[model samples]
Target: MLDDTLKTQLKSYLERVTQPFEIVASLNDSESAREMQTLLQDIAAMSDMITLKTDGQDARKPSFSLQRTGTEMSLRFAAIPLGHEFTSLVLALLWVGGHPPKVEPEVIEQIQSLDGDYNFEVYMSLSCHNCPDVVQALSLMAVNNPRVRTVIIDGALYQDEVNAREIMAVPTVYLNGAEFGAGRMNVEEIVAKLDTGAAARDAVKLSAKAPYEVLIVGGGPAGAAAAVYAARKGIRTGVAAERFGGQVNDTLAIENYISVLETDGPKFAAALEAHVKAYDVDIMNLQRADQLVPATHEGGLIEVKLANGGVLKSKTVILSTGARWRNVNVPGEQEYKNKGVAYCPHCDGPLFKGKRVAVIGGGNSGVEAAIDLAGIVAHVTLLEFGDALRADAVLVNKLRSLPNVEIHTSAQTTELTGADGKLNGLNYVDRVSNEAHRIELEGVFVQIGLVPNTEWLKGVVELSKHGEIIVDARGQTSVPGVFAAGDVTTVPFKQIVIAAGDGAKAALGAFDHLMRMPA
Candidate 1:
């Protein structure tokens, strides 16, 4: 099933496999089963240490398991692991065949030491960029600990299973028949969830760390850039992030990140992390800062308190906590999230295929979502609070040209209506006519905009009316030795390139401030 170039690459990757492994597929007479068999054959043909067997009796047809020879270590895929999941399949093969993963030693040890039986089933879409992370993470755990078993299922291929579980989101994970999580999660995050004592241990370790010269309170593009710049200055630097990549992880196509022609969010975010890691920056992932405590005396350390009871102190702090999706805050919006209301069109769009859906907002994101969904869904109803669309002319034109898209300007979403834990429709009002309206749909995609992640700093820092941190030209905030940048700051445009530049400027500003301080 793979092209010649892909075959060559797969062969090269499989050469790293040191131990014997086998692909045991459970097949049927369906075309997908044949395709899966071809894929397995191509993969098995790459390495002499790898073997293929089609005699397995799995309940799910077109499914396969990568099993290490003479061991219970195995990972299963219930669908063709192509598209975004192809890399996940390759990683599973290598890891299952005794090829070491590029994870930290401590993380590997933690995975190995996990005591409980973890039967993880992940429902993911092939188009979802975030799915691979979850699949790979669980695959890593499964490869390390025999007690942990991960089964990756393609949601599009297994629509019956998805519907039965009422799964409306990609990368929805179920642990032992219960909903575990329903979004992008990394290995550390998953481990923390499984290991109850991990938070206290992490908090203790974080609190004991020495104060840094520059401490970045985010891990998006801004925080990464700041870390690189600070580390280049040969000063102590640390980064604390709720989740590395921030809002960018939910982003799909990023065509305007200069020099690079085109790339997705996950790849770009991974690159950012790798670049920051190349330096001596101490990165604390899955760490959410809840409060900022400024120094009482000049040249004193600024303290950033984490939600996990961890406190990190620094001489100069850069606030780049980034932003999150702005919810409509209407009734049932939160309650129906993942039930039918989704924020990411790219991730959840497939789940609504052949079903009527609504897009909230008339900006570029909303219009783009409508345009994209028109092809996959039965119909897209776009509601805008303004009289006119705020999207680019090209996007507006494209959206208008689509037959399946319906646009409603001056429409305010008042409530999302649903029953039995599933959304059925949404209620809106027309400002022009003052008439209330309701549209029946299976899914609602909120694409209004982002809200800065500055709620924690509401009373701590000087904020704009919109809750963004007020910063000067040098990315310096109102407080002395405290700088802010990225989406969390009062930056005009919240672009990746802009955020990175702001971060660098903030890092330089912090360095200059530190130079003038008394030792």
Candidate 2:
């Protein structure tokens, strides 16, 4: 399915291969096997060093294993690698054949210490950008350990299995038959679970007793920044975040975050966590706060109740719970989700390197995505349901300057079409002409809006009609001793730089609030 341009790119990647590599493809005379066989053959043709091995090990379940020129690495994918995951397939081939992944030695020790065989079932979609990191991490660990077995299942291809498990999101990890983890998690997180004997997620907790002087909620840039600032003050500070890095974890290409010229979501998230760990802040990771226990007395303490039967007490609290991506809930969108429908352009753009793609909601984010994808993909079609784009003049101008970009305002997307568990095209309606249109594209990126993660604080604190916490210039909310920052507040803009500044302001406000209390 690779075009001439994509072939050229793959050829360049294969040029770096020095050792011989072999692909042991186990498939039956099925349609998926036929498609996978052709795809793997094409990949082998790109490099004289790569060879394909076909045999019927288990025709019921498709499996592909990659080994060194003459040696076996024991790394394999039990399914076809298509859509956005094509990049991951290529990377894994290169890593196993040429350069081995450079994982931390401490991590290697943890993996070596792990006993007993654990089978991991990771649910993913083709267009899911974040799934590859976790998948690759598990593959690397499996290559290092004999007992760490993994099965990568495409959610769209196996909808029945997904429905049976009640799986609603991508990157959902299942250890054995029960759900283990959801959303984005790295290697250290999985290793942490192994260390604690925690079979599933949600059993992990922080200190339930002892009230901290300052408590920060949320784990995005704003919350992380606040915790760093507060912890630097040499006071008892703790941050209770559902997931550290907030919306920043799902975002891509943060070029406007001050000195950094360019960076992706996962890289920036790791840096944020590393920066926070350098201090003495008690980071309560993986704990979702359900309700806030308000203090009645002047010197009484407040409690932060969590969903996992854990509670935290504090004298002051800062809310930095960030936002989530706005999804386009259309037909076949949920079905083909990672197959060809995607949310983050930066993470999955490379998968559609030489393929045609579309961007929905031609606002600032849509325009930005078009600009980003245009540089990588063959063409970009941007759709907007409004009369005109609501973006900065510079962004629109840059988008227009792109040669492979087409913008269509007043265009309402009707449905996403797919076949063979992958997306192939999309349908839209022209508002002005009142006519329907269809376009053949490999991927679709939804970049419309941001939904704040503030539903858990509804009745506890004063919130705006849109559910964002109303805060003043000092980042103080309606409730005393409580502050909010970042996208979760009624801030003017949701930029990373703005959120980081607001976090610092909220930290200062919380510190000031605590100093006035009895010591």
Candidate 3:
């Protein structure tokens, strides 16, 4: 029998180790087993860093074996792996092995070159299956490089941390101190920022005193288009954005946009940014607009305040601020989001081919999701708590025509169910009938309406009841010298082509305002 002194010493040693470890019990006697179980439970309760398992069938075993690796450490349990527990055994082996298969060697080198200690934490829910590849890639990078440490924090497990970080979506990677990258990024692209130390810098630098003909906020389709048009017109233009692509980076495909029959959002945004960069347009990234006020000199110039405590003077301002997705405030919704529950149908639809899925919300996004998923998934159940869909006639017709789509009006989701630590189905109730039903689905896509990203512009510009900026045909806001465009503005459609065209109009309007300025 193991003495209390020996158990106490083992517990003390285990507590000091930072590496991930699994505990395996092999004691034969009932008293010894109880003590070992208690010790394991105490350790697990202390931190999420440790895993525990018990093995009590073998009485002949006198000793246990322990193996250590880079990622996981394993201890042999005197029991057979069977039934549901067999998977756990496999997981223990995999965890202890530390090696998670193989990835591209170039990807490894790219991650290894990154200087300084980087705690790259990716917040993801278990439901987002597609996110695993991205997480795995990041994990592989961490394995290859000592300076970089990758961790996948369950969004549900750490609610307070998620709230503090303002994580709205899954697969959100926080680098070092601030929010670094979002969505899925390839290894090469991630390395590019590290290689140049551009992303690692404090912030994008801009000349404080230099006067510009036009200053554009945001860098999505609208903002990028405005920058290109203004630069071509020989106007000294500058664009400041938190991120270059804005909301367009979240998009998966662009079939409706003109001149581009088929294109990915990132690729399109990259091309637009490149075209603008080819000219003399100055692009400042990772800069947030704090405020806008009248300039000292009259004639339509404005003073733009930045989050970095910097100021810029501009002849005119074009606000191409876009819209953000509405979130489902359900339990485990945030945790499993990006895992099985997603916001953008276009971004994640193709990934769930021949899978059973459900779409929440009855608005335009809801109808769009139903139509999109009907073509891809084996079956799609559109759940709307409203009486009817609020989409345009064209979209409504498309959604109704899909045979694989099933519309459930006045339906509300109560809970999400999962198995094997992954999303499996959902429990929903009918609003009118008060009847509840369980659905077995591989994915749940939230198609709720978008919220305009105009909270920052409150009191600065005239906004509609829905918070959309009120802009004229030329993308000129009610306030002279201040222009708005894209979905954030009073645009009829939130299409890429429409946003691009509106951006052009906003830039032209700014240029006109600039030309009339007093020299």
Candidate 4:
């Protein structure tokens, strides 16, 4: 805990930094023992402030404080700032310094009507750039409605808390004692949740439902392309997506995708979505389709049931649901995802340009990212849990020939280490020698493989042994009026151009099928 004199100094420093035109008062305790309590109270009084109290076994109670006054803010971390936590503190201070603009009055009133103290805490890692928008939206509700207090916790800083909550991804928001929302959330949806009294049961019953002619599931490059092509063909197409851009949106860049020389994932996704919207496509964001039931007495009609209980019926269905990256499931892997660990090499590799990067897995994607990064990054440490690289001979040769690339055969990642909130490096154990060595790296990319997004399909469609949707040459699935394309299907390459072409083929197949049906 901070002493009275130190607390006063902190307050003074904050005031000086923020330069709040409004008169600021510093409340300090005369006694050293009472200082910590006073500081906590002072922080609680501020409009937007966070006070972190740390009581580790070895060290004295360290109280880190941050406060915002107008345009400026001050950060004080009592613990020895190291690893991801240090980076988290810097970002927290930056967030305080740039307080979001006041929300609209109607929105404020809607949030304020809720009775009782509702505490919403969102746990996220800094690597998720999409999370800040959600945090800002929640903060607006907190500022307007005093009863609703929203806290954004850096997942890395609160690893134990994240583990207790069983957080599997970034940008997971918890309302009160239960999970409220995850990923990115718009302001309107959040306001609706708060207005419903924070009752998950009640909230679930109040969402809206709609039907579509052509319901496209997934939001990856393939899905987006399908939506665009279908909409342009004068078909009433609607996209039901868990996320706007799926796996492609999480990428750093797509240089191999022709025409676009080099582009980031989020930016490319935004462009793709915008292009789809330019037509008449209805994009239902953040909606996950859980089940697909064949419509009774229908000419190739399907009813898609969403996880949110909303039902969408369509004459045709296009499943472009892409795959998810596989993880090692080792200790600290989940805690360090997006902190020092990442899944997409193209997305995060540039961030470590001219620095060392570790690529996990012996597969094609792992070897490819490693070879790609070797050209730009200073050094590439490729760790393959197996004795040999599982990629194609050409890729393996390319990787081996790179001067900066080091292949670690039969090496397993044991631990991830970092200082502040950024990745510092990782430790690996050699299976052959049973010896361990740590390498300093700016990033680690996990490219073991991908699990197809076909779990929900179950009995709805025919899938290959690898779980990939089995589709005909014309992009038609076993089920009539339902088509599968891109990486989700058993197609050859997982490139963006191939996905786009697959999307086009699916749309044409659906159009031909729709034309043959009687009115």
Most accurate candidate by TM-score: 1
Residue 103 Cα positional deviation in candidate 2, in Å, after optimal superposition:
10
Candidate 3 — which pairs collide? 125-335, 127-339, 127-340, 128-338, 128-339, 128-340
Ranking of models by TM-score: 1, 2, 4, 3
1-519, model 4: which lDDT tens digit per residue? 445664565454344233222212222332422454444455433423344332322222333334444432222332222222333333343345443343456555676676677777776555555555566566655545556666666655455676566554567777877888776575657875565543343225323434566788887888888888888888789888877777776665588888789986767877888888789988776677888887665485688877767677888898998888878777667666766577756434544557788899888888998988897689999999999999999999999899999999999898877665566778889999999999987778888977888999988889999999999987889887889788899998787789888988888887787888768
| Whole-model lDDT per candidate | 0.93, 0.80, 0.69, 0.68
**Candidate 4: regions farther than 4 A off:** 1-211, 297-300, 329-359, 363-381, 385-406, 410-445
Candidate 1: segments with Cα more than 4 A from true spot: none
lDDT of 3 by residue, 1-519 (tens): 235664465455445444565554555555534554664566455435566555634332322223343433213332232222233233333433353433356456567677777767766544443244355555555555666665555554455666566554565777876777767664555665667753333333453458788889999889988999889899889998877777777665678876779976656776877888899988876677878786555675687777666777788889987888877677668667656777766545655667899999888768877887788689999888888877899998888888888888888888877755456788888899999998998788887867888887889889999999999878888777888878899888788888989999998888887777778
Off by over 4 Å in 2: 1-132, 143-145, 150-183, 188-207, 330-332, 350-356, 374-379, 393-405, 414-442
Off by over 4 Å in 3: 1-182, 185-204, 207-209, 328-336, 345-356, 362-379, 389-405, 412-431, 434-443
TM-score attained by model 2: 0.69
How much lDDT does candidate 2 score? 0.80
Q: Candidate 4: give the clashing pairs.
A: 82-420, 83-418, 83-419, 83-420, 84-420, 84-421, 85-420, 86-420, 87-421, 252-347
Clashes of 2: 4
The candidates, ranked best first by lDDT, are: 1, 2, 3, 4
Q: Indicate the worst ten consecutive residues by lDDT in candidate 2.
A: 199-208
What lDDT tens digits, residue by residue, belong to model 1 across residues 124-162?
999998899999999999999999998999998899999
Residue 518, model 4: Cα distance from true site in angstroms = 1.8
Per-residue error (Å), model 3, residue 384 = 2.2
Q: What is the lDDT of candidate 3?
A: 0.69
